[model samples]
Target: MDSLNYLYGFGNEHQTEALTGALPIGQFSPQRCPYNLYAEQFSSTAFTAPRATNRRSWTYRLRPSVAQLGFRAYPLEGLKTAPLNLVTPPDPMRWDPLPLPSEPTDFIHGITTIAVNGNADAQHGVAVHLYVANQSMNSRVFSCADGELLLVPQHGSLHLDTEFGQLQLAPGEIAVIPRGVKFRVQLLDDSSRGYLCENYGAALELPERGPVGANGYANDRDFQYPQAWFEDNDTPHQLITKFAGHCYLTELPFSPFDVVAWTGNSAPYKYDLSRFNVINTVSFDHPDPSIFTVLTSPSDGAGWANLDFVIFPPRWMVAENTFRPPWYHRNVMSELMGLIEGQYDAKQHGFSPGGTSLHNCMTPHGPEAEVFAKASNDTLAPQRYQDTMAFMFESRYRFTPTEWAMQTPLKQSDYANCWNNISKLFDQNDKI
Candidate 1:
């Protein structure tokens, strides 16, 4: 037998018969070699190790060999591939509130801005929105679009109805909805809501930890995926999809929320905000607002971020010889801030809860006259800020005032007056 013949199962004359259609072993022999070894050798010798097994007739159909199936078992290539169809929800859909009958159950009203009509043009974009439920209406449905929707519920409990199933999100709970899914929200109690991020890039993935390992903010187990909810409702309904800048609504003859059975990582989920391991300074001054940035959309402009959604939640305000409130300054990114509850340390009175203020790109804002005076003269003791939660939706794009925002009576007439109080504190000797 030659070396090639020996490498294969073909040895001598007996193997030659096995190479033909005849069985390798005769009636006396117990073991029955299915294919003639010689023919199998002849057919497979031309191929490589992994290729040879695939070319084998019996082996090809029986099962893939270890080398041939290794890529399948270890899907490194698939894992590294980028996601297809990355999208952001329309900002207008967020403004549209679903009116429900008055009741005492869990009901909340939420307004989303970043998830609205924002687009990601070679950069990630973040949207800011709010939720206000009078504790009268129990729930509202949120039909998710073709991208990830991160819900930073500032206040109240949210019962999420997702394709997978339902999840109860309390205050400080952060939920993420994958693209192309429909879900609803049920307030566990009457509460106001504030959210910051609207991710348009890769799904709002858990922040990566290099070397340091898992040490801070939002662990994986803290995230809760809804249980499976399988329903067969054949009712006609509209499926609204937001792409580019417009909304495309398709009417389906059945409830689009129908996900009778699905099991995958690509589903809507929620996480507790309290679980965030807040990173802040204990000694000198307040860190940049970016510290509270639950998520950031990176921009092509070097270190500059496209959008940095920041929060000013109730926290310890105890930095000696330092102005406790956000230091007065103008920011390059446009800022749209909303007060969910309590007094904003920056403004003493006019910017009340539920009120909004816009500091367009490069506009100077922060610490109106009264707030500055109080903070400058007050004693520097360890003070715990209580009952206050304010959030900002900072974006890179220059936001043009919407016709409704600019023309509607809902616009605060006294917004410009917020700066009027500054003149009262101007001392002739304090500055030239």
Candidate 2:
């Protein structure tokens, strides 16, 4: 793999050109662009959105996007969207990792939706999917029209070739491809498996630092954006788009990744999870998980999130006189968690790396009974959690499992048994 160049800073207005002066110097669009390249504007937010929150980009391509045409419905099973016509029971759920493909399967063909919430047409909530692929998308490209894609790779490395440029992601890294951006995935290993979040809300932004000040938790400089790179191949290609809860295929006479130059903040970007400066409680009690949020899609309601991407990276714990592991609780926000590398501290077993667990709104969840018993009797010395990377997709709306997810053998039917062994320990005369 070639070492690619990147532009830095989160949400920075970046400019890059593969050829000298391919980008117009004076303004975003001029009457005639340099090298006679066509200028097109890609908007990720509404035109009337506030300046601080607006996201748009200008691309100088070999040919305008309009030239690529001819779209037809492409039926793809297992890939589902929001507002599914199904009922969701208020039960905690868990699943083993989707096994890798036995046959040759590309990223586009390996996606299987697990659960979804809110409405994609209304532009809110998210859909969770798992991808397992053994092949790369060589002549095929994909884009989502309904939402931005947040990819969390759990098994192998991926080489993403997009219109903007290329990004390489491994197990401990994440990448966000903006809505309507064309890209193809190339596996760097023999097989790959990971979790994907389709966020149909406002574009994700770095959460405000609040009293933690301006420096901790996903700093701006850590986000990496691809520099301009393009292929001028004229070979026939295919474009698969997920639009309005369905898949559409378009035949392209040539490669759509022909952008010679691009300048904007709306392109796909990646961040190393290890770069996240974790902020936590060093004094007494556990802080809300919001402290670990790397990015968030805000809703209309203040202090409420359409979706939040939070992580539980390896960190030290020093909270005295309190249970070190997460406590039992019920929450209004829905939570879907995935393990990236090692065992999650909450579950001693069954919750292996690449596995997933869901706790919908008001669904009770926490450490398993075995974990609780051990934590209760263990010493209170400060401990460091090592070799673990657990993360959660938290949302304001409840999740509805898809038919495939509910019927799949990977669904752990005995998930609730983890807490069944908790014996009653309350005593009337031994109250603290």
Candidate 3:
């Protein structure tokens, strides 16, 4: 909000203070903090994690977090957890845009789990959710004790107030908030709708560019981390925590975001998807979609990822003679794709904006029959794909959808019809 000052760099140890001389020199826990503030440590990673990957923040706040009364069980409706109410249907699935609720809902109440993988208790998987809200959160905060969240707004804008600061985001942009960061989501337009990936594995990091070198894809500088800003309020507030796949509530006399100064790499950051540096073939053949990865949550195994956040943005198709659309085949990774705007080259017919399509592990999925035919016969010319933004949450583990996701009205019943008309093109008698 306040002119949007930010500290740039991913995983860089950053320091910011709301007031002058608020941060003490040389020590994280000084004998006494400036302005008689309380010193606290908020750790995002385990204490024994590698120094390179460890994430902990030192915050100087007016009151310690102990100001809250004991937490009580708070049952959140429509939000399901992994391995519960999940169906392993083998058929490829697609869904239309989620309709806004008729009843008034805020961000927290609007969230509905679509699918979940891995385990929150083990912190090794992810849960995908759809959130649509018509009202703003009033003095309410949500923090995930299980893992971090990668939020993508597909409809209206969102004014996200976090412990770090306020981040304003719209469609084609994303905000990644590390676990345990208290924040509130308020509708910026008439309503706000979005997708959220609750990652229970390692925190998301920028994908490495091995041969592509230092520049390409999402740059670290483009990731905007909010500057220091805090709310010094005494009004009663509600705080909710998602721990062990269950929601818990705590009522505090003041806001949890009362930090006056903080320094840590474990902070929330936002990036505009338009800033991704596109890299495509100037010669022939389409590269693997891994080249489009913006962020990744790496598993312990090599060449395997817990989750890959990939995008198919506007780029040039200048290959000399090649099938411009994606090649047909299914491998190991399960893909959950969402379109933010425009038509996807693979499924121009049924995949609409705010919609999602899925291809489970080793399932046959590619361009539709019409798209395949059109791209196969296209001329060899440099084409600029414009006004399109689609993204995928690909994972090594298969995503089992909840009952709501499988039975919702938005679920397209005839999704397989697009691929049902693949004709025998190789049986040429008069052709060629």
TM-scores, all models, native as reference: 0.63, 0.99, 0.97
- How many clashes does each candidate structure show, in the order listed? 18, 0, 0
Pairs clashing within candidate 2: none
lDDT of 2 at 378: 81
Per-residue lDDT tens digits for candidate 3, residues 148-266, read 99999999988888887778888999999998889999887888887999999999998888989989989888888888899987888899999888899989888778888889888
Ranking by lDDT: 2, 3, 1
Q: Which sections of candidate 2 miss by over 4 Å? A: none
| Model 1, span 173-255: residue lDDT tens | 55666544556565565554545344554344443334437665445555555544534465654444444333444445554
Candidate 1 lDDT trough over 10 residues, lowest sum: 1-10
The 10-residue segment of model 3 with minimum total lDDT is 78-87
What local distance difference test score does each model get?
0.48, 0.93, 0.88
Count of clashes in candidate 1 = 18
Judge candidate 1 at residue 416 and give its lDDT: 55
| Local distance difference test, candidate 2 | 0.93
Candidate that would win on TM-score: 2
Give me the runs in candidate 1 sitting further than 4 Å from their true place.
1-147, 152-157, 170-172, 186-202, 205-214, 233-235, 258-264, 424-432
TM-score of 3: 0.97
